[model samples]
Target: MNEERIIELEIRQAYQEDLLQALNSVVAEQQKQIGKLEETCKLLHDKLKSLARAEPSPGLADERPPHY
Candidate 1:
């Protein structure tokens, strides 16, 4: 009985180890994707800011059309 219990424990440990490794890999990939997304967001924000700066301020030039 003791030997059987030991074997069962070993099997459980092995499965746990495999699960832990899989979880670690998934987390690492998610982190890398998050980093990439953050970089893209920053670039888009900067481009928008630059475009806003280059555009004319709200005034006669930006009036709505007569249809509106």
Candidate 2:
């Protein structure tokens, strides 16, 4: 093989390695974000469930709408 051809091949390989590393980093970050999102969703679900089960304070029904 010619020297130029060998150099080109090496450059291409380096680029491929860098691309793979970046992709892996992106995937790791995405996985972490997904975990956080799942926890947040669960917390929101629990809060909504508690609010649904809790009784309202007395006279809440007496609040007037802006149309009033």
Candidate 3:
């Protein structure tokens, strides 16, 4: 009986170890994706800021037409 119990415990441990490894892999992949998304967001933000700088301010474009 004791030997059977030991075998059962060993099986459970093996399964647990496999599950832990799979979960760790998933977490690592998610972190990599998150890093990529963060880089993309930063690049887009910088591009928007540069574009805003290149454009005219709000009131400048709304002036009366030359026909006035």
Candidate 4:
């Protein structure tokens, strides 16, 4: 009965270790994806700024000067 209990405990420990490893891997992947998304957003923001600098946007009818 003691030997059986030891084996069962070992199996549970191994299972828990495997689960922790899998969770770590998932978190790492999510972090990499977030980093990539941030980079893409920054690039897009830069592109928008460049475009705005290159040309004026159209809707300026009710205009106010800097003094206003």
lDDT of 4 by residue, 8-27 (tens): 99999999999999999999
Model 2 lDDT tens row, 1-68: 69999999999999999999999999999999999999999999999889877965457678787788
TM per prediction: 0.84, 0.73, 0.79, 0.71
Query: Which one wins on TM-score?
Result: 1
The number of clashing residue pairs in each candidate reads 0, 0, 0, 0
Better of 1 and 2 by lDDT: 1
lDDT of 4: 0.96
Global Cα lDDT for candidate 1: 0.96
| Ranked by TM-score, top first | 1, 3, 2, 4
Per-residue lDDT tens digits of candidate 1, residues 1-67?
9999999999999999999999999999999999999999999999999998999578876889899
**Each candidate: what lDDT?**
0.96, 0.93, 0.95, 0.96
Q: Judging by lDDT against the true structure, name the best candidate.
A: 1
Off by over 4 Å in 1: 57-62
lDDT of model 2 at position 11: 100
Candidate 4: the clashing residue pairs are none
